[model samples]
Target: MNHGPDDLSSTGEFDSDELALRRMLQQAVQEMEPRDGTLDHLRKAVPARRARKRQAVVGMAAAALFFGTAIPAVVHVSSTGTSANTSNAGHASQTQGGAGQGKEEEGGESTSGGSAGKPEDKGKGESKDADKGKSAGASTGASSGTDPSTSTAASAAVCTAVQLGTPTATTAVPDASGTVYGTFHITNGSTAACTVSGPGIVTPAAQGAADASKISALRHVSGDVASAGLPDPSQEVAQLLLQPGSSYDVKFAWVPTETCPTSEPSTDPSPDPTTSPDASSSEGSSTGGDTGTSTQLLTEDGTTDGSVLVTNTAEGGGPSVSTTVSNACAGVVYWTGLLTSS
Candidate 1:
């Protein structure tokens, strides 16, 4: 009873008691044993329980997502259905009102007819209705602002030679291809507007005064060499309308022959030997003492060669317009359809 606390902690009795408690706890733990397959069952059951909990969580989340989307879709469908029903109701009401108004009009017309029993009165009413119909038709036409038939007839009036002014032409210098570009301007000098239906007949004038063999062959073509700057013939209107003072153009190109024909030498006898001795001797020696045997090449100026005369006659018989297209040699002449001038 008088011993101190440190001296008690070193006593053999307290140490032996602690050792006994430890031994008993060890023995209890060693002696304990579960039933057969308890560990395996615990292992399987624990995982199965955790899996169930996970499945429950996933199911709850999926249900929440489904409801979240489904509620808005349901609401939208309901609103659309309501709007459609309202529109249908409104259209139905309008249709019913129109039908009722028609019925009322028919009733009023019947009542008025009953009041006016005379056959003459009925005929007068019909006449008035006819006049009203005519007036209505006229008002409709005025409202539309144009008559197709009248416009068509006005535009269809073809131009005659008397209505056309004197045609003028301008020719450009020949290109490397020997193609000369020119435009024949035809003016509508008449006061009234007229249409040119198509490209009129183009023909080479009868070889008058010029060599017949050297006349350029006239050919109607859409386009040809050096025609790039000219208007496209294919795009021309079928009926070209020309107002007063307005002019149209007919583009043409002249292609000269590749080679020119040589002219026969003059038939005049060699210079008289009795004339001046210097001139007679020079001319006689130059002529090789032959008369009319020398050949001379034709010049490309068309003055000595030959000129092409192009004549354009409007379709349906109109006074023809002619132009002298100078060509160095014989070749084809290309002409295009009527084109609106700039």
Candidate 2:
């Protein structure tokens, strides 16, 4: 009702000269400051999500170490499972007697028959002290590459020469390229001479021509022996020392990888892939490191029950494979780093 400022601009809107010229343009604005490096370029680009969670905890610790402890160390190519002179701290024998030395006598094992590969097999509760052990060359002779008589269709036979807790002497390896040449066996259970080596030979890697795992030692034998005796006439093990008596046959030999998946059923390929390069052991992992592979067991002989296995063969073309053993130790000083698949 007081309409004065130029008659209130003819009733349009108030503008006391444009409200004092917008308060002099908000007092001449000016206040910026915020550009040091923009937080150092996001802290140097953040290392791509902490490098993919440290490569997935190292690819699940290398996929549980080849599906867990190298399939119990390949289950048995004497495959490197455990008990090769596992060492109870007793350690005494090997005085220097060639054929079972002092003639033997210690404390446990003896009475085979069990785990021929599963005939619903029962027998494995005794081997700790089965009546003081002894026996060898139970005789059928042949087993250099295995052919007792040659009649394997399978229900048994991955390896069976059960005596239980002593056998394992012969030491003399050199192949897989180290080229030591001929004769390789160990652990010949002795209580007074030739102590306990229990296991020997290692050649557990093959399949080359550019893959490059290629290892060699052979003679691994150690099936968690609930028993392992027998080995005299110089082969050793008359209980030079390996308490609980003796029952051992932790033998060693393997050959399967000409692409070796073999459709999972074999009678005899018997070490001739061109000349037995056998004893395979490829086993790898590295997720964030970026490389991964899996396989743990491969055999060619066990000789009874069902003859231990898991296989598939095909390569160059590629598409047949197998190796899986989850876990099997049983308990105390037993070893079965065994193998048999030809």
User: Highest TM-score among the candidates is held by which one?
Assistant: 1
lDDT (Cα) of model 1: 0.64
lDDT of 1 at 104: 37
- Poorest stretch of ten by lDDT in candidate 1: 145-154
Report the C-alpha lDDT of model 1 over 215-253, residue by residue, as the tens digit.
555545445553564555565545565666777777777
- On lDDT, the leading prediction is 1
Which regions of candidate 2 fall more than 4 Å away from where they truly are? 1-183, 186-192, 205-210, 213-250, 260-342
Which pairs of residues clash in candidate 1, taking residues 3 or more apart in a chain or in different chains?
none
Q: lDDT tens digits, residues 1-342, model 2?
A: 565445656676866777566556645643545689977777776776688889999999999876877666577636343455443221222222112232322322221233122211222324323422322222212122222122213222122122122232232242342211112222212232112222322223232121223222232233311213312223433122222232223332222122223235557655556653433211122223343333233345421111112222111121222222111111111123321211
Number of backbone collisions per candidate: 0, 102
lDDT of each candidate versus the true structure: 0.64, 0.30
